[model samples]
Target chain A: MVSKRMRVAANVKRGPYATLTLQGEVIPSHPGQFYMLRGEWGISPLLGRPISILGEDLARSEIRFLVKAVGEGSRLLHALKPGETVQATGPLGNHFPLSGWDPQSPVVLVGGGVGVPPMAYLARRLSENGAGVIFCQGARTKEDLLLLDEIQETGVTPHIATDDGSAGEKGLVTGLLERELEYQPGAVFACGPEAMLRAVARLCRGKVPCYVSLEAAMGCGYGVCLSCVTRVKEAGKVVNQRVCKEGPVFEAEALPWL
Target chain B: MAVNLAVKVGTLLLKNPVMLASGCCGYALEMGEFFDLSLLGGYCLKGLCAGGSEGNPPPRLCETPGGLINSIGLQNIGIEEFLREKAPKLRRVNSVMVANFYGHSVEEYAAAAEKLQAEPCIAALEMNISCPNVKTGGIAFGTDPKLVHEVTAACRKATRKPLWVKLTPNVTDITETARAAEAGGADALSCINTYPAMAIDVEKRAFKINTRSGGLSGPAIKPLAVRAVHLVSKAVKIPVVGIGGISTWADAVEFMLAGAAAVQVGTALFSNPNAPLEILKGMEEYCIRHGFKDVADLVGAARDFERPDCNLPSAVIVTGEKVRK
Candidate 1:
């Protein structure tokens, strides 16, 4: 819950994507938990951008984020250099649960574009815990694929899909999930574009338990400003849940998908 | 030298002039994770009604240059849930709690006020008349002076707690509603709600928010808010609570100098959850630097400078001592 200035350790850029590392008294974060990061100090862009935890090294006191220069707030973050300061407020929101998992079944992890960071972090945690892991990622092209070396460093080679057939497969990540579902994966966890997650949720509907991390344009990432709410069906009633508070992650079945 | 940061809005005394605007800080519980709630002068809870609302659809916010547009549609957990769930936790927070509520009609407003009246944790009631009137085919209650007076009087009769009417800035003359609220037995007036505004995404060829238009708040609206406070404070005899894009201590001081008895920080809390306490500290430093023994003395201080024959006070003397007293 601490909000303070943390010095940037490095901004590793790969095309338009960046893996930003910050060194400071970092807040310990769980997989799927995020930090509200604002590059520099000003009111031009009023609120902090919610960035998911790409990696955390408590030993080094460093936190990492995978950022895409899509918007003003993120462009500010992507432009940071080593020794620059960032206003960080976190380990905010609920994290992906690692309990009650069956050790024998393969844990299928799926990600798309900037949404891959949390899945990468989750993959590392699950593998370290001695759980069977399978990773699937999709992007528009080979160059658009983010954090490939980082995911490979986790000792799990990703089953990649590119839109233009420049990588592993030439289809959406859901196509890979459809193939993996035959192996009876214990659980499906995904973070990606809405269309891909929706397809993943559909593919694993009755066969396997599925969890999807959500995203929205947020004002305050701390539950006050109700800017990032998505509809969830609870107790047979549809209600809005704040992505920053109730979750950036939810059981896919809880969501009201059309 | 010591400085007194306390100020009174009607009979409701705040330890300082720093309060979190309604619908901005939620119940102040989330903010407590970053800082202690007792550090604030007071906070207006999110707007509530009887049955609660689902609010608008997805994409409720849009960011402009130095400002934010939100169409949250007053999503709240309703009075029953607030009283049963939030109120008990808030009772332990030690800072003043103001219940902000709204309704579509006069009777609904009165009923909502009465519902919150029995809660011992709530010190004051702020009536949000910016809601559309269902009886009048969606015309806003605060937009019309008559409706403002009617609704304020109805709510005033419903509760004996200190009543503060939050005036909307969509009206042609904000002071008209301010005076109406005062005449209708409002103890104080919260001047200037968010200005009606909109934003569109060119790429998507769609509106930024689900609701095509929303209310704008942030530094962009500060100057407009200051002018509203200045006019409304002069037009009404009761205390005026300034709110609109106040992000810093200097902004709060500017509101006070323009004749606001107290000021509320809205969108600023989104950027910095520690803003209220920070602004409070900066205000204390400002009082010490300006040689004013009391922060309340700064209210309407700028207005005194406009007088022709008045004897100007020295730097050591506190100006506008008689403005509020």
Candidate 2:
């Protein structure tokens, strides 16, 4: 619920993407949660862009975001110089489920492009909790495979894929996921493009429990605006749930993916 | 010098003139996590209808330059659920709570109002006749003067609570509806709901919002809203509560001068959750600077101006005359 101006500690660019490190009195947050980040002042781009909580260090009060320079809002975030501040309002939406998870069975995490950041943090937490973790990431090219070193630091080697045959597996990351599902992983956690998520949901439908983090164009990142609603089936009836409020995370079985 | 921020919308007395608009403020309780709800003069909770509504589909919002078009379609958990889950929590917050309700038909509107009238936490009721997102009920009930009067009268008979009719900007003359509502016994009027607007993604070659068109709100519509508030205020004896792209205290003051007794902050809360309080502080400072004893004194403060005749040179009329029928 905290929204304040945090100084840009660093901006590490990887081609069209950038991992922004911000330092301040960070809001307490978990993996898969996000902040609505924006410039200190502007009305042209009205709403704050919702950026996932890629990483955090509560002791140092530092937070990180994986931003893609795709539009006006993210471009503004990527172009920020160190020492400049951006308004960060966050710890919003539900986080990845961690409790009651068995450490004996392996946990598989799927991330694509900018979606890799949250999974990296999730992998670290699961590994720390004595769980065997497998991280899979996909990108357009070898250069787009983000946070290889970071994911490795969590003591898990990310199974990588590139669309152009420029990386580990020369195909979609879902191919890697399909291969791993054979081993009967305990759970599948994912965050990525809708098409990728749909594939993950389909692959894990009856085999293992699956969870996904969703994104939408939001007005107010709170419940009020109702801008970020997505359809989810509950009690045999389909209903709209706000991605910012009801969840950015939901069980795969509930989503009616086409 | 002490300044009184309190203002009256008919019989309903708000601590200040700044309240969050309906639809923009949710149920008025979700924001308690960010700040104290009591800081606002009042907040009109999201529009509720009979049996509740599921709202519109995803891709519900599209951002335009300095504005946003939303087609939330009046989603709610139903009045029974609100009373069961949210109302108990709402009772704890010390602020004016305005329950905004709508219906697919006039009887539905009355039933929803009557259902909400028993809640002690609700200080007033804002009947939404102007939501542009829905297909049948909302804006359809707002565009015509006869329908506006009919619906207002139905709701007026349903509840003794201070009734405010939220007018739609989609109408040709906003004043016509304003007069009709007043004649039908509306205690107050909320001038100008979001303008019916649309946007398209040129790359995708598709409508940005699933509803195709949505209600546009934000700073882009503020001027048009201010003009509507002025016209509506003059047309009706009831107080006008201005709503549109009011983001700052100066904007609120502008509305007051244009004839609104109170103002609502809607889209600005998306960008800055603290906008209402900041606008409240700014309004207080503005009053202090102007040596006004009360915020109510600022209402309708703008003086009438003489129309200046335009005397353009003959050379400027060349294309105008040439294109004549």
Candidate 3:
């Protein structure tokens, strides 16, 4: 819950995206967890921008964030230099359920565009734990795919799909997801645009248990503001759950995605 | 000697003049992980109603130059659930706890107050008449002087605990409403809730907030809030609790000088969870440096000093040994 001004160890740009490695005390975070980051910019953009945890190296006491120059905040983040500092408050929100997972069964992961980074962290963690991992990555073209070599270095080759047919499969990522479901994965985890998450929820509906990470424009990346909420069904009644607190990760069946 | 930071609002006594504003601090338990709640003078809990409310739809907030507009619709777990879940945890915190209640009608406000009246942990009740998100009974009761009196009078009968009526800033003259609340037997007043405002995404051709409009809070509203507190405190005889965009200790001092007995921190908690405690420390330093033994000496210090002829003595009293003018 503390907001610290951490120096940037590295800001590496790869095509349209960038990765920022922050130097600070090690923050214990799991996959799908996020942090709210803001630059020294003035109050024009009053609140901090919510960024997912791409990876962390506790040995170096550094955390990495994979950012795309989508808006004012992200654009500022991408332009950060090596010595510049940024304010960060985190390890906020829920994380992916990896502890309860059975090691003998295969785990399927679905991610798209900016959503692909956490999957890389999840894949490496699951693989180190002696569980089989399969990753399905989606993008607009070959150049749009993120962290392929990094993910492949983890000893798992990703099943990639490109919409323009310039890469592995020539359709939506869900097309490859259907093929992966045939092997009967023990659990399915996904993070992406809402449409893709809905499709994945539909594909994994009754066949296997699934968890999806949701995104919302947040004022405070904590429980106080009540800004980031998703409608969830509990006991036949739909209630708005704070996405920053109760979840950024939720069971697919618990969500009313139609 | 240590500075006496304590202040009284009706029957409730605060350890200091800094309190966490409602809707920004949640139930206090969520923030307990960051700092000790006992460091604060008090904290006003989120607004509650007779029944559970789901609040407004998502895209509930947007940022302005120096503030935020939010239409959260007062989403809460109802009084029964709050009593069962949050009150027990709040009871353990060593600070004054004020329950903020709101409803769609006067009767509903009374009913909610009655439910919280028996809770030993709750030191007082604040009736929220300034919530801009609800469709009825919120800003409606706060705008008109008669409606303000009606709602306060109804709740006055419901609870024996001290009642503090929170006023809306979206009015022609806030003094009218302040006087009305005092006439209705309110023990204290909390002036200047968020102003009704909106933001739009011109590129997308849509409102930035889901509810089309929301309440504005932060540094942008501080000057306006100080003016409201000054006017309302002058118009009413009851104590005034100033709130609206108080982020720093200097801001809290400005409110006290303008006649607020205490001040509340709202949107600043989103950025810094320890704002109330920070303000409290700064206030103590300010009192010691100014050679004041008590923080209450600063309240209403600027009320009549601004007048051109205020320094002139109207009457001269002659004592036995010396003439004191």
RMSD values for the candidates in order, in angstroms, are 4.2, 4.3, 5.0
lDDT of 3 by residue, A93-176 (tens): 999988666667799999998889888888887888777999999999999999898789889899989999999989999999
Give Cα distance to truth, residue B130, candidate 3, Å.
0.7
Q: Of the true interface contacts, what fraction does each candidate have?
A: 0.75, 0.78, 0.62
Local error of candidate 2 at residue B25 (angstroms): 1.4
TM-score of chain B of each: 0.91, 0.93, 0.93
Give the CAPRI class of candidate 2: medium
Model 3, B27-58: lDDT tens per residue? Answer: 77877777888988898988988877889987
Query: Model 1 Cα displacement at A248 (Å)?
Result: 1.1
DockQ of each: 0.79, 0.74, 0.58
Global lDDT of model 3: 0.88
